[model samples]
Target: MPSSAPVAAYPTSTRPVSIPGRKPRTQGLRNMELAFLVFAYVIVLAALLQVQLGVMGEFDFQLITVFGFLVALTVAMHLVLRFRAPQADPFLLPIATAINGLGISMIYRLDLVNPDITDGSVPNATAQMVFTGLGIGVGIAVLIALRNHRILQRYTYIFGAVSLVLLVLPLVPGLGVSEANARVWISVGPFNFQPGEIAKITLAIFFAGYLVTARESLSVVSRKFLGLRLPRMRDLGPILIVWAFCMGVLVFQRDLGTSLLYFGLFLVMIFVATGRLSWVLIGLALFVAGGTVAALNMEYVRKRIEGWINPFDPDFYEASGGSYQLVQGLFGMSNGGLVGTGLGQGRPDITPLAESDFIISALGEELGLAGLFAILAMYFILVSRALRIGHLGGDDFGRLLATGLGFVIGLQVFIVVGGVTRVIPLTGLTTPFLAAGGSSLVANWIIIALLLRLSDTIPNQATTRLEVTT
Candidate 1:
């Protein structure tokens, strides 16, 4: 593509010549941001130590592994941004680091309670920190090499096909692992991963690229109904295909949460591309119909619905399909009250999967309602920053990609939180930074990378002030 092509994929800072007038410049505040990041690390490390001290009643030097992991992760990322992306967003890296560090702390606390595992491997806390480092490594790689977000657009079809394959891999014989009634994991030797987590990123790129090329055709409407434009029947083919795929995931993979996420992401991107309410209405109708049919025919879906609808019923509560986990999370949070019971003081380990799916409840029990609000506020800030980047993107492709990525984080959090609070049926999904899943951490960190790259493209004043007098 040409430097001045329709998308302007080249960096503005690289242009040797500019309009001759002087312009004000705003520095990227990179050093200030790095300082704040270090401060946040201090708090997180202290919190983790507090947990250890409370439980062990003594200072322990064995916490060096966690310290080394954080130092390596932060140093690697900090060096990358300083050399390669000095002008990127300041808050995102810090926010992610804090959330991820706190998650490890919570997991370590649970590890203390458990103390022993089936095969007697390393501690869950150490394993989680290792994954955290791996996640950071992916982000740094993306930042160093893929300086522009638009490059991914060139291979949209390839990414789309790969995403589809990843979604189906867990269904293959010997690879798929069925746990807690969801066959969404693939076991490779000793390692287990959810391909759907990686699929979210690839599929977002697919949706963005597909919509950008097809928006002109999909945007036009021949008929108006009640002052709203309804998408043409011919234009609806793409969404129908995606919707059907999501239904397939629901049926074959038995992962209702991932299916809902895929469908919701596509729906949002289509609406943003076409500015049509009719598409959303149609998309929602399809999901509801598909979900209803699945609920009737699929025993797992039926059980999920029954559990959501009647959690307290005598037979249902005690049955294998019961909402015991949900109810227990609620109780744990309630026990937390206004302020938390303090770290290591409460028993969040009592809940099933407290380190992954129900990490929020674990935090709630230890950190209290007030602490949860603070944590949520941090998430709100992170999402808002990503959306702000999307809003300022110069081209449709960048705009849509940023929007889709931001919504990926927001929607996942809402789904996990809503499920815990009983606002929606429980779907077994990992919490973003707060969960103990490596796939989720890696995927989310890559998202952070993309957002940083996207933000870098929107020229700050400093980027445009390089014009010389000639």
Candidate 2:
């Protein structure tokens, strides 16, 4: 009996296993990365200032302060990202920092040319810098907190509604400040906000979400016409409505850049999601027709066309009432030639809004063709990265979102660069990260963050599947 009892005892069960959450020790490394970023920024800023002081004989301490503050803000953003979304793509925050730093440097350079903000005072580069910091802060906060694009997709409609409200708000009596060209900038205290920038992001989300939901139906071939496959006639209505609405916005708001951006984005998304070349052809035909009609009916559009054809022809310039801005831009770019006059040594002051629409010209004057191509390369990298993210994304919405965003970057760069070079009619669109606008900078940072989040999710999804299989 004693021997049987000794043999029958079972091993005691082990205590339940506990897995620890991955602590963000990488936060220290992130801080080091941010420190390197700030260091690079300081080097660039110092180089710029040295050049300016050598040529112009003076430097502004206010501008230095602004740079310092912006650097501080960027460091803060990195810390926030480490604390919140430690496992997120590390490249994103540094890329954002570089972009923002570049923008600030450009703005500071412009401030040198137009230092008088209010009757002999140094222009408030500090203010722009502050906004840049704020934009970076908001971008990091959104990316860290949102954590997933699904949540954004879930509320796409609501975001669209809010964006639409913001877009139309300028139409209200007192809120919108209408310039001579018909852009409605709302001035709040000292800050001017362009709702169109915000609208672009919201509309892209809505378009991506809507397209993902409707992809299969839209892809269905109802018939063919002239060797071109066509979608069901019912399916065409939604796209048509979107196109018409965009046209209305163009006609009413005089926002040619926004209108073109929206239409192009929609067409590209439709083509990509459906993988149909026929849709692209149909969209192209519709675009041609609409453009022709716009040119004929809209005085402003007609002017743009005439300006594009021959900016220097006196008769065309007079009839189209082409302003001095584009002319100055051409002059600045031409003065630079192949190598440029060198930073701080060129006459970029002649170009109106040299910090915004014509910043490329300024960059050309200062940094030469090499610098211009470098900026273009950055845009190309950004677009390629977004497309890669789209391709690797696990879900239709994420793919569409990434693609739509890539399309946006492509279109904006084309429009702005073409406008500056006089290859197309001047559309007053900022050159994304390099332009001096609060709304544009902020909106673009958010775009970068979303793309990074999407990039992060792709790997995580793949890893999860592999783990499940194992």
- For each candidate in turn, give its C-alpha RMSD to the true structure in angstroms: 6.7, 5.4
Report the number of the highest-TM-score candidate.
1
> What lDDT tens digits, residue by residue, belong to model 2 across residues 359-408?
88888877788777877876787787788888888889999999888789
The TM-score of predicted model 1 comes to 0.92
Clashing pairs in 2: 115-123
Instruction: List candidate 1 segments past 4 Å from native.
Output: 1-28, 178-180, 461-470
Could you tell me every candidate's TM-score relative to the true structure? 0.92, 0.86
> What is each predicted model's overall lDDT from 0 to 1?
0.86, 0.75
* Model 2 misplaced stretches (Cα beyond 4 Å): 1-43, 58-64, 115-124, 318-323, 460-470
Clashes within 3 Å, all models in order = 0, 1
The Cα RMSD in angstroms, rounded to one decimal, for candidate 2 relative to the true structure is 5.4
